[model samples]
Target: MALLEVKNLGISFGGLRAVNNFNIQIQEGELYGLIGPNGAGKTTLFNLLTGVYKPGEGSIFLDGKNITSYKTIDVNKAGIARTFQNIRLFKQLSVLDNVKVGLHNQYHYSTLEGIFRLPRYFQIEKQMNEKAMELLKVFNLDGYSHYKASNLPYGQQRKLEIARALATNPKLLLLDEPAAGMNPNETAELMETIQFVQKEFHMTILLIEHDMKLVAGICEKLTVLNFGEVLISGKTSDVLNDPKVITAYLGE
Candidate 1:
């Protein structure tokens, strides 16, 4: 069975359809790309998959279980985690603390244990700290573990956001324009980091990005959306060279 599947997925805003008749099936450990011009409903699809927005029609399944009606937190708990187009980090929190926040859901201790500083609380907190540091190391942000998330440079902040999402231990990871606002060097490093994460974690990833170079470098399969509908879905190179996709998106 596919790790993530969406069939006939759609959503509307008032009188306008934002996403229409979308369908995809992602297999285990595959890297997929969803690309299009502005207003192509890319981010809307991410929102629907992550439970930020419920679909008006169609079903979403992860690991063969229906998650169409699941809440946001429940969706995360169901093994899907995502990073946003705009970096969202706790500005005032230390980098380590930010990752630990994602690890919070994994804590087995009760609220009472946490309130009383019981042994279970301390035990779980220590383990989470160790794991969070390990994740930071993967992004080369371990040195900044004690630094405030807001104090890091823009590129590092983006890495921190992805680290936090990884702490959730998701089977499926969705990234929305993860390389946005990055320079060439940073975007290059991010591509390597994403490749490492997928290999190390054995996770399925679907990304919505505008950088054709990055998408071509890493994505095994591609899907193009135009005006809220799919323009094409196939191998990355074929999708990139398709005249229809070029006319509608690449504009050449």
Candidate 2:
């Protein structure tokens, strides 16, 4: 069964259709790309998948379970986690604390235990600390664990966002423009990081990226969106070479 599936899904904003008749199926461990020009509704699609927006028609399934229109938090708990196109870190929190927030989904103690610093709280806290640090180390952010999340360089901050999302232990990870604002060298590093994350975590990823180079390097399959509709979906090379994509997306 596919890890993620959407069938005939669509949403309209007032009289305008923002996403119309979208359908996609992604297998476990696949790295897929959603690419388009600005306003192609790529992020809107992410919002829908993450439950920020409910679809007006059709169904969404994760691992064969219908999750259409589930509340945002509930959708998150159901094995889907995503990073935003705009970085959304807890700026006031320490880098470690930011990651721990994601870990909260998996490890928890009662509120009383937290308030009183009970033994169970400490136990869970220790486990989360170890795990969060392990994730930070993967992103090479371990040495800055105590620093404020807002203080990291832009590239490291982007990495931290991904690490935190992974801390949710999600079955599917969605990255929205992971290479946005990156330099050529930073984009190169990001490609390696994404590849490493997929292999190390055995993760399934679906990302919305404008950087064709980054998309080409990592995504095996590609979906092109144009003006809120799918232009094409197929093997990366084939989709990139499609005449429709050349005319509508890349421009002849």
Candidate 3:
């Protein structure tokens, strides 16, 4: 069975359909790509899957359970997590603290217990810190764990956002334009990092990226969208060479 399934999914604002009749099935450990020109509804689709927006039609199933209307927090608890097109981090917080915030859901102690310095709270906090550090190490950001998130360079900030997302222990990770601001060298390194994270975490990834070379290089499957509808989907080579995809990119 697929790890995640989107069946005839769609969303709209008043009369404008932002996404239409979208369907995709991602098996466990698969690395998939979602691509399109600007305004192709890729981000909109990400929002729908992550529960940032509710679908107007169709259903979403994760691990065989319908979650078409699950709340955002519930979705995170269900093992789905994501990073935004623009980096989102707590600027003033240390990188370590930013990651720990994502670990909140995994920590079971109550706020009162933390305030009172209860034994259970202390234990959970220690565990959370250890886990956060481990993730930073995996991304090679352990050396900067004490730096504020806003102090990191653009690429490092992006990595930190990803590290923070991984802290949620998601089974399916939705990455929106992870390499958006990266230079060629940084993008190259990020590609490897993404693959490493997927293998290390044993998770499925669905990424929305505009860089065709990067998408073609790493993603095993590709889905192309245009004006909020799927133009084509298949092996990367086939989809990129398709006439419709060419037209979509050129016409824009």
Per-residue C-alpha lDDT of model 3 across residues 175-232, encoded as one tens digit per residue: 9999998899999999999999889888799999988879999999999998899899
Worst 10 residues of 3 by lDDT: 243-252
Which of the numbered candidates is closest to the native, going by highest TM-score?
Answer: 2
Estimate the overall C-alpha local distance difference test score of candidate 3.
0.93
Candidate 2 C-alpha lDDT tens digits along 22-111: 999999999999998899899999999999998999899999999997999999899999999899999999999999999987897999
TM-score of each: 0.97, 0.98, 0.97
Write down the TM-score for model 2: 0.98
- Pairs in clash, predicted candidate 2: none
- Sequence-dependent TM-score of model 1: 0.97
User: Which parts of model 1 have CA positions greater than 4 angstroms off?
Assistant: 250-252
Candidate 2 displacement at residue 61 in angstroms: 0.5
In terms of TM-score, which candidate is stronger, 2 or 3? 2
Clashing pairs in 3: none
Candidate 1 at residue 11, lDDT? 98
Consecutive 10-residue window with the lowest summed lDDT within model 2: 243-252
